[model samples]
Target chain A: MTAAFLRVAILPLVAGFASLALAADIPTAERRSGSEFMGPETRAMQDDDTTNPGMLWVLDGEAAWRRREGAADKSCADCHGYAQTSMNGVAARYPAFDAAKGRPVDLEERINMCRSEQQKATPLPFESQALLALTAYVGRQSRGQAIAVADDARTYPFIAAGREIFERRQGQLDLSCASCHDDNWGKKLAGAPVPQAHPTGYPTYRLEWQTLGSLQRRLRNCMIGMRAEPYAYGTAENVDLELYLMWRARGLAIETPAVRP
Target chain B: MVVLACSAAAAAPGEPALRSFAIVGDAIPDSLTGAPGDAARGRAIVFNRQVGLCLLCHSGPFPDEKFQGNLAPDLSGAGARSSIGQLRLRLVDASRLNPATIMPSYYRTEGLTRVAPAFVGKPILTAAQIEDVVAFLATLQE
Candidate 1:
């Protein structure tokens, strides 16, 4: 073959192989939930609703759903009506596109949006007991359901952005999320097993914190571990990262109100 | 704790100032504290969770320790594998050798992004402490 023919055909093929190597996501069959890494005690806590502390928040959320608040004098029950029916599989498709805001929003933001637009209530502060309760309640509805985040033209760029953040090394340690969750997963980091970081068990109850926390709280904790400045809650970057994690965790069964060490 | 005394000359209020040094090949040939670090004190730093945090991502020759990390290479034969200068360089900043290393630069204070307020302008370990870690790692010949 002529030099031009070799350059045209072989170089592109080589480049394609290189790109594939760089972006090698874990095979679908190999994806494991973070729960699998927990100790038997923690796993048992998650498996049983009676023992799970996260259930307390879920119960509180049930009450909040029915209680009337704000000037509109309407409860979440009035509009959404029976979270068990309306919110089923809802948490599975979060960090979804918002046409009005021209951006992606997570489950927490969606609840706030509904409160302001539908119930005419004040947006709940992030990480507050009330918000955590509501999130856990709604997330519990999607238990055992597979994560199926939106992956269309509108969300493609944001997912890509999240992927960039996941891979980019930051902080004094200069380690990326991929360095631990992707590369060193299933291995022990000082007695604790490093999990594959699927977002399947968010709005989870952590034994260390002794309370329920959102995925944003967990992400911020990880950023701190890397000695990096964590992004504030509800930031575009945070939502984008959630979008990417949920997309990566597609088909994994949701384990909301999960208890973890 | 013994290493803290060595930093008196370089201490700036609450902060420990980074010591200047030259890189020779892939190593820093000089002792960071001018005096050779105490190996005993170095061992204490390595095993001290609040100080070194080494066991967080490394498995060493300490049989007494129940929990050891599996992230980085085993530290059992570290001295047999590297020179004292090399160990010093690795502790100071392993990222200099491999940019993607999860090992924190224990003595570097510049070019870092978004450092927490409590850790601003501070390296993970002081210069004397880095020397102490290097000294201890150099003794792990087995």
Candidate 2:
């Protein structure tokens, strides 16, 4: 081939191959999580229940578990007996698809399902202390378990929508979740390290928030940060995104009540 | 919480509709507001959490701040690569350039929902602040 041919055709081909190699270098689900990017002190905070402020909510959840409410006058403990056994590994698999609801439901939604259906009680408002407490308590049960959201025939559609949201950019800023979590993770922008943003921990303790918050709250924070209008809590878009995140971080160990700075 | 940077009086009686400009290569003068641009004030707006909140997703030369994120590009030498026009276009509205960008439009008011009531019908920054940021960014050469 002529030298001109190489300059025009082969050079662009070489650049394309380099881009593919760079794409391959990004971490896979097995090796990536926000926890790895955090400092030792932050990790320790998530590890030790005593040091973790999120633990306070877990304790409240434990109390709420046994306290009877609603017309039926029953408690979570009444039906399940003990969270450690009955609720174990359950949080790791949510925002699971509910065949009846025809959509995915996160841990909070599922808890409300049990409350409204079984307890004959009113569902708690989103971001309320009682809901955060119960979510923290139930999420704690699945600690150390690997996340297991899936993309089966029944769930593939919502998972697909979630993936679209992850990749599709929006807002006045016109950026997507992938721009950070998928593209720029581990890079330092200001001074903080970006993580793969695995949703392993929900109802996490964010130092920025100065209190315990749900994944929905964090998602809203991100939307605001992006300069996009946030979806109302409990919207299909939000739940679908959560489902996609859970599926994305499928193998990562659950760290419910995680600490984030 | 939205920060009313200058004043409601600074706003023109009839704000012009947000014009979709091409990814910028030319500087836009203080068009919407006639106030003189000030760079020092721009830096304040960028760093303040109640205002620009730029530091949340961006990092710059400032060292006193904590918990600055890495989701977006650092601004240490932004002036070296981008012109004032480019920066202004980005700050005004980036979605038109790349519809999927996560950056907020500092100067857009239309097509947004769930905005704080106080910020309604008002851009996040005035034309003067946009020029001020453009001025400050222009000084950040390597």
Candidate 3:
């Protein structure tokens, strides 16, 4: 059994070890904005900001931006001031390394950190409506701005872990994420086109889900789809995965509050 | 419509349950009761993504079927390469051959998690369905 497990675990690495870092690495043309894979009707829905269901959350986010909360009596606007100006492009460069904490944090985790530290407020629960609204609102600020997350030596380990997770086979399905997103993207599944899964329009609305969702929520859904155990919210594994997604999607424009089927 | 989950059509308690087949070099225990291979039924199951859902990872020569995936080997010539016993073993449980294979066990149910209640202990495909799939795959010599 151990021998079988070792063969399953190590064989793929041994097989792909030589050129694994070369031709098939990131910055390939496989990158596609999520919008490219959707049906035209859905694409049309996303194109019109007023018609997109995601915009409703963006409106809620606009309200949350000004509404005061927390023990510190601070709203997001109190510190950042006008998402159009202050928060612009911030979403594009997130999953940044937190120097003081000595870890990686995606935008959602960063938002939670601010709530705890700066606002003296308890962190909003994961997948909460309020959190989704605020994230969507903040994410919308970077529309059309290219993703530019970091991937230097300091972040190399996290990036590597993220890549490893992408390639690792997990769950009862024994499927790796790359099996779908990398190998068979653009193909149809059940009738829906499987996009390259570029993380360009996260905190976006999904047709399967009538409400807006964070990237973590979507990742959780994928884990469940594959029957794999998912990382807890705010865990290093989740953040590293997010960082890898951001790096994989580097230079793609942000499309927060975007709608998808 | 492509029903992603194979949890539908539950067998009542005491039906032919999912039998465990130990890997014996590309051969699985075949013949359940009086069931035998049926190509027509297998072809329908293969094309119907909801039941066999083999098209999710495999592409083959089925007209009018779109979105044939490319994650695994194409099944267009699968019959030519593999014998019926080999095909049966793979369909029963590919994991027994390669533990990390992305292929789901269509007829095994021991180590799985999050399976819908309707599917617990019930294999994704029945013994007859497995035979049907094997028969259909065997016809794909070209």
DockQ (CA atoms), all models: 0.36, 0.25, 0.22
* Candidate 1 structure quality by residue, lDDT tens digits, A1-261: 322223234433532212322225677888999998888988998999999999999999999999898889898899888999999999999989999999999999998998898888999999998888889999999999999987777887787778768877777666678888877888889889999889998899989898899999999999988878999999998998999899889899999988889
| Candidate 3, residue B88: lDDT | 86
The reply for model 2, stretches above 4 Å from the true place, is: A1-26, A29-31, B1-14, B18-36, B49-124
Docking class of 2: acceptable
Could you give the candidate ranking by DockQ, starting with the highest? Answer: 1, 2, 3
Question: Candidate 3 on B2-95: residue-level lDDT in tens?
Answer: 1122222344567754543444455654453246688998899998867887887788887678877765788989999998877987987787
DockQ of candidate 2 compared with the true complex:
0.25
Please say which candidate is ahead in DockQ: 1 or 3: 1
* Per-residue C-alpha lDDT of model 2 across residues B93-122, encoded as one tens digit per residue: 665565545677787776665554455567
Better of 1 and 2 by TM-score: 1
Off by over 4 Å in 1: A1-22, B1-17
Fnat (0 to 1) per candidate: 0.64, 0.43, 0.26
Which rank order by lDDT, best down to worst?
A: 1, 3, 2
User: Each candidate's iRMS in angstroms?
Assistant: 8.0, 8.4, 5.3
Best by TM-score: 1
Which of the numbered candidates is closest to the native, going by highest lDDT?
A: 1
